[model samples]
Target: MMQFHDAAKTNRSSGKVARPRLLAAATWAGTVLVLSACGGGGGGDAAPAASAQVPVTLGTAGPGDAQNHLPLAVGHSWQFEGTITEGANSSPTSTTVTIPSTRDVGGATALVLRESVVAGGQTTVIEEALVKDANGVAVLAAADDVLSKALVPYWELRFPLTAGAPFVQLDKTGLDFGEDLDGDGRNELVSLYSSVQVVGVESVTVPFGTFPTAVHVRRVLELTVRRSSDGLAFDATETGDAWFAPSVGWVQRKSELVGMGEKLSSLERLTAYTPGSLGSAGASQGATSTTGSTLATEPAWRRVLRASASAR
Candidate 1:
């Protein structure tokens, strides 16, 4: 039997009220948009020599903490090939997420990130900022408008990761989305719930190479959008899995959404990546930053495209 965790709608941060609530789908709510693209690649691609080593062996897939397992550096970039699956239809997808630069926000030095998705002869790009302090990595607001207040910053990854450990990322959060749908010139209310956990360590092989000690993480997102004015309601749920290698960043990811009266899925396999120096690259800098950040907190909503690049 499949066990479904009761995703609660509690605020994970300080409780503050916004004059007008906004829908997060435009930004962070995107974590669940693509899930059903299906394809298969059983071939192995050659990768560069193992010149890189896991700096901190705290959780050597053996003993250590996962706080530093993910490396985010400025100028760091990764391109992924995704496949989306619908009832008898499948399509290929390509996307890239990069840290453009770094900036100061609320006393925390954050990284500027942009993710571009191309599929179905169209392109959609989303930009967000994030920072990893003692609390973990969180996505910030793009502007100073009601968004920063209406929508809470989305947390991409959490810390102290241990095998078989579980934690809720976002509580049952309810807010009114400022976007107008149905061409009725009215915003709708969206209820959101999400959570992530470190499943364990495993050896996974991808186009990049074989990682013997990759951390397996899983996430689930559920939302309900309601328009009290027109009596419209939609319910959706998205689940995702990702493998992260220490010193390296995200090696691969898979996501699926099975609600909202539709099926959408996506897979992100690292095709090519250059983990630059680890701070957070904002602009063009010759030096590499010393930390890690994600390309898109939400790369959902798009057709799937497939392409492979020779491993470097």
Candidate 2:
């Protein structure tokens, strides 16, 4: 993720830039929400919402199902081109996601997806560890050059995709990004609450090709940043919609961030895809036992935040 200082330097000259705190809050919110790639499903005790019609079961053709919306095979890669617009300024950006290998995450074999993003002449790379089972895909850990952290296992996509059935993606508090958001020379603690739902299935066209059966998923995120010393807080909301093609993976995505007198939007479309040879055996390995496993209840970032508060 881009640092808060980088963002400040990028938009400092603009008269329409938001307040210092709001700018940092919005930037951090976008980094966390938009950077995480696609998929949606229910987790833990959360139940799927009722559907008016029969729910569509995706990738149900047994092991190595060719119709799986998200293929976790090594060597699979996706390229995207997009633009980010804030105020009247817009910049071109590109992203590439690839599954370089698989590693054990919490005793489960998980695909290591490396996502490289280039925007405004800066490149940022993030590595995510994920596992997929019959239920859906879950993210276990994520890291970058600056920080590495394990996440509370959460479903990125749940099976039997149904319209209007939103599932909780993440509802965690006390996230400290280690950036001085309020300019008090200390980072603030933030909370993230998000949910995802399959809005509909539609034909979506992009540079890669026209996907006749694209599952449109919508994710809504709320980020709250609080300063401990002054008890000041700010809230930001982000809504993202992604289109995933069966057997092809994510095809398009659009997201918008709204906060304290600022709005930032981005749109990305698939430009290329490279399929991997590894089949179901690679994807399902060590994934079975990880289903519903709840070893870590709190994220490492939250723990750090709690410790920081106590020390102060």
Candidate 3:
């Protein structure tokens, strides 16, 4: 929630010096350091081997297609709850959201959410019962911060694929997005614009069932009117092991984020997921089948940032 203030710390405002230090102590961890150790060489790491692009298709997608349900039209609400973890600390969080199924003026959807964060016997709150649109051509509302602001331009683009799209995007402006971990014909979207990376896919065995996960890195930004200079860019990655449920759709997603540097911030295992209440409510559910899903493998990206730029 804190921004990296190179100019602020050097200036004479009220509490600017301690601001950066305080933020570092609370939000900084070993995320960037770990990324550098593994893949942060020369802007980004090497791409996977070359492969063909999966053709986009559409059909009867079930609840498991939640990830692909882009342009989330009007009159839909999803409830979520999870936890955030750092070194020696873990806290619970909850969110209730409503969004338009169609794209608004900017190709974004309108979103309203109520969120609560709890830590150390204290809780912070945020409530938004208003409409917020996106900034893309479709006006599809994507994810945003607590203030209901768009994070990146591509985040505005929604891929309505029956299965995941197999592709990689590398640009110096943001992230080098790429993934095809499962070889199931679908590739994951890894974006660097917000410093969020999809590292790998994970299979988690839980009490109910086993889920195939997409690992992601999410960095919280500092909010400011100046889009270029605002928002804290701390490292936060989550491994989302998402499972397709019969009646309810995708459920039981587990996530985690690790920070870097002296700030010592990190997010442990936070399980945020859609519940089975959809079936219990007697809503006519779709059949469980992999008919419209993709299952092709993508080629490994072997180029550096320059050649990979076209994927952006």
Candidate 4:
């Protein structure tokens, strides 16, 4: 189970709230949001040994190519079951991700993905607009149940996954914290930066099944919180690993967050998946359709942090 720390007692200087509430909330939100999209096992679980490796062939055809490891199509959904642990207490969790429709974002067609996560008896829903191209999959925008505004887009995955090569996923500053912590009547500023690298290929087993050609990707996120009132700042970091199977999306994921004298760890595995159909005609039609507003112009990380705060 994820734990929320008491903001009042976290960092107090002269009886003033040095570290705002959003500091912990943003850290937790970033950790969960970053780790929730992909797949992998628990941090303590290891992949199969070399002797268990299996030979398999993957498709390389267009957007739905198995090599991309993410097949985006409307109506596709994935269900995951897992456990969240903080110290000695643990709680069961479940997540459901679905692609319900398509929209036009940044002159490209993007699929709308809705993810519902139930943890600690609370449900949080996240909606992301994603685009899959030859370059890989990227998020065009994001929104959650708590925030009325949508977040700006960022790269979720890059093409040509290779080990030892790390790419910057997001590096932006002056992001909104979406709350007026410290009773300052003004929202704080936040800086979010992250990088991702493909570790290697491994065979992973979960409730769904055993996948021999799962691509393992590791991501490291660093968040810096700065108070708009007086320039007070603090730092937090989260490390996560995700496994993607050929033609199937994410199979498992593990994440750990540490900061502000708090640590949280979680592991999730694919339990069931239903693939959607996006025939050649449908794909072409999606490209020509211009339905929704471009999502890149909105505030990006602010909504994510706010959503997590509400979850607690």
Residue 134 lDDT (model 2): 74
Task: Flag the better candidate by TM-score, 1 or 3.
Answer: 1
Per-residue CA lDDT of model 1 for 150-258, tens digit only, reads 4346567666556764555544333444444434555444444456677998898888888898888887654444443443434455677888777666778877654
Query: All candidates' TM-scores?
Result: 0.67, 0.68, 0.35, 0.70
What is the per-residue lDDT of model 2 for residues 189-286, given as tens digits with 9 covering 90 to 100? 55455566888889999999999989887776544445545544444556778888887888998777544455577788999988875652335333
Better of 1 and 4 by TM-score: 4
- Alpha-carbon lDDT, every model: 0.50, 0.55, 0.27, 0.55
Minimum summed lDDT over a 10-residue window in model 2 is located at 34-43
Whose lDDT is higher: candidate 1's or candidate 2's? Answer: 2
Q: After superposition, how far is residue 175 of candidate 4 from its true place, in Å?
A: 2.4
- Arrange candidates by TM-score, descending: 4, 2, 1, 3
Candidate 1 regions with alpha-carbon error over 4 angstroms: 1-67, 142-149, 182-185, 278-312
Model 3 misplacement above 4 A: 1-75, 100-103, 107-151, 156-250, 261-312
Pitting candidate 3 against candidate 4, the one with the higher lDDT is 4
Tens-digit lDDT track for model 4 on 206-234? 99999999988887665545544455555
Best by TM-score: 4
The alpha-carbon lDDT assigned to residue 124 of candidate 4 equals 69
The TM-score of candidate 1 is 0.67
